[model samples]
Target chain A: DQQVKQNSPSLSVQEGRISILNCDYTNSMFDYFLWYKKYPAEGPTFLISISSIKDKNEDGRFTVFLNKSAKHLSLHIVPSQPGDSAVYFCAARAGNNDMRFGAGTRLTVKP
Target chain B: DTAVSQTPKYLVTQMGNDKSIKCEQNLGHDTMYWYKQDSKKFLKIMFSYNNKELIINETVPNRFSPKSPDKAHLNLHINSLELGDSAVYFCASSQGFGEVNYGYTFGSGTRLTVV
Candidate 1:
C-alpha cells in the first residue's frame, strides 16, 4: 500500500507567482518528510526536507510545511520560475526504514 | 565527472531474458540504493547497501538481486525478465545508512523495456 500520496497529478503557475504542491500520508510513524524534483529522463533530486519535530523548513525560495495533526505536507515556491518546472515527489520515512514516495506532481511554470 | 552513474540509459529486451544494470558512485559515500519507478510513477526502494553490506531488502522477487562488489559500486541483476518489470531503475547514494542519511544523489535512470 502507498503510505505517501500526492493527490494532484499536475500544477501550473505563471512566472513570479507562488506554486504550492501538496502531499499527504497515512502512516503516522513517519518522522521525516522530503521533496524531490525530477526532469524528464533524469532521476529525482533532493529538494527540501522537514523533520516532523518542526512544522516548517525553508531553504532559499523553497519552503516545506508539515502538519502532523492532519498528516499533510506542502511545498511552496515563491516567485516560481520557468526553470523550476519539473516533477515533484513527496517522500516520508519512519526512522531507519525504507522511504516511501508519492505518485509525483508535475509542476509547470509558464513564462 | 558524474557523482553517481548508471549504465545503459535504455535497454529493450525480450521477456524471459536476463539482464543486469550497473551503478557506480565516486562521491565516497558508503551507502548505495536501488530505486524503481513503475508505471504508476512511484519511486520504491528495492535494495540498500552500506559498505558492500546488505542493510535493507524490501519485498521483492528472488529474481531481482543486488550485488555490491565494493563500497562505490552496486549492480542489479534480474533473471527471467517479465513485461511487468519494464520501468525506470535509478541508482542513488547517501552519506549515512539506516536513519542518519541526510539526502540522496541519484544517477540518471536506466529505462528498461521488456517485450
Candidate 2:
C-alpha cells in the first residue's frame, strides 16, 4: 500500500505564473511533510516543509500548505521560472528515521 | 567537498556475481541509510545504521547485507546478483535517527545493472 501519493504525474505552467502541486497521504501518524526538488541524475534537494501544527509555511517563492483534516498538502510556486522545472517529490515522516516518498510530479515551466 | 559520496556511479555486472557499493559521509552525522529506487521511481529504505549499529532493516533478501565499519561509513554488499536487483541505490545521512527535524543528505547514487 502506498502511504503517500501524488495524483498528478505532471504539471505545466507559463513563466511568471503560479504552479501548484498536490499530494495526499493515508497515514495519520505522519506529522511532518517535506518537498524535495530533483534534477536529472542528481539527488533530491530539500525545498520546503510544514509541520502538522501549522497550515502553511512559506520561503521565498516557494510555499507549502497542509490540510491535516483532508490528509492533503500542496506546494505553490509563484512567478515560476524555467529553472523551477524538475521532479517534485512529497515525503511524509511517521514511524522511524526513514521518510516515505511519493511517485513524484514532473513540473515544466515554459518561457 | 561532497557531504555524502558513493563510489562506482555506474556498475554493470553479470548475474550470480557478488558486488559491493561503498558509501561515506563527511557530515559528522551518526545515522546513515541505504535507499533503493526501483523502476517505478519509488525510493524505499532498505537499511539504516546508527553509531555503527544496525537499527532498521527492511524486508529485503538475505543476499543483501549492509556493513557499517564506523559511524561515517556504511557499505552494502550483494551476493548472487539477479535481474531484479537492477536499480539505483542511494546513501544518505542525518544527525539523528527517526528525527524528521533534520532532513537527510543523499549521495548522487550508484546505478547497478544486472545482466
Candidate 3:
C-alpha cells in the first residue's frame, strides 16, 4: 500500500504565476515531511521540509504548508519561473530512518 | 566534489545474472541509505547503515544485500535478479539518521534493468 501519494501526475503553470502541488499521506506516524525537486537523469534534491509541529515553512519563493489533521501537505511557489519546472516528490518519515516517497508530479512552467 | 556518488549509472543484464552497484560518500556522514525508485516513480527505502553497521532493513528480499565496508562506502549486491527488479536505485548520506538536522544528499542514481 502507498503510504504517501501525489494525486497529480503533472502540473503546468505560466511564468510569474503561482504553482501549488499537493500531497497526502495515510500513515499517522509520519512526523516529518519533505519536498524534493528532481531533473531528468539526476537525483532528487531537497527543497523544503516541515516538522509536524509546524504548520508551515518557507524558504525564499517556496513555501510548504502542512495540515496535520487532514494528513495533507502542499508546496507553493510564487512567481514561478522556467527553472522551477521539474519533478517534485513528497516524502514522509516516521521514527525510523526509513522514508516513503510519493509518485512525483512533473511540473512544467511555461514562459 | 560530489557528496554522494554511485558507479555504473546504467546496468542491463539477464534475469538470472548477478550484479552489484557501488556507492561512496565524501561528506564524512555517519548514516547512509539505499532507496529504490520503481517505474511508477515511487521511491522506497530499502536499507540504512550507520557507521558501517546495518541499522534498518526494510521488507526487501534476501536476494538483495547491502555491504558497508566503511562509513564512506555502501555497496548493494543483487543475486539472481528478476525482471521485476528493474528500477533506479539511489544512494544517500546524512550526518544524522532522522533528526531535524538530517538532510539527505543523494547520488545521481543507478538505473538497473533485468531482461
Count of clashing residue pairs in every prediction: 0, 1, 0
List, in the given order, the native-contact fraction of each candidate. Answer: 0.68, 0.47, 0.64
TM-score of candidate 1 chain A against the true chain A: 0.98
C-alpha TM-score for every candidate: 0.97, 0.97, 0.97
Off by over 4 Å in 1: B98-101
Alpha carbon deviation, residue B56, candidate 3 (Å): 1.4
Candidate 1 TM-score over all chains jointly: 0.97
Tens digits of per-residue lDDT, candidate 3, A1-111, equal: 999999999999999999999999999999899999999999999899999899999999999999999999999999899999999999988776678899999999999
**Which 10 consecutive residues of model 3 chain A have the lowest summed lDDT?**
A91-100
lDDT of 2 by residue, B4-29 (tens): 99988999999999999999999899
* Window of ten residues with lowest summed lDDT in model 2 chain A: A92-101
Candidate with better DockQ, 1 vs 3:
3
**Candidate 3 residue-wise lDDT at B95:** 83
Fraction of real interface contacts that model 2 preserves = 0.47
lDDT of 1 by residue, B9-113 (tens): 999999999999999999999889999999999999999998898988999999999999999999999999999999999999988744432678899999999
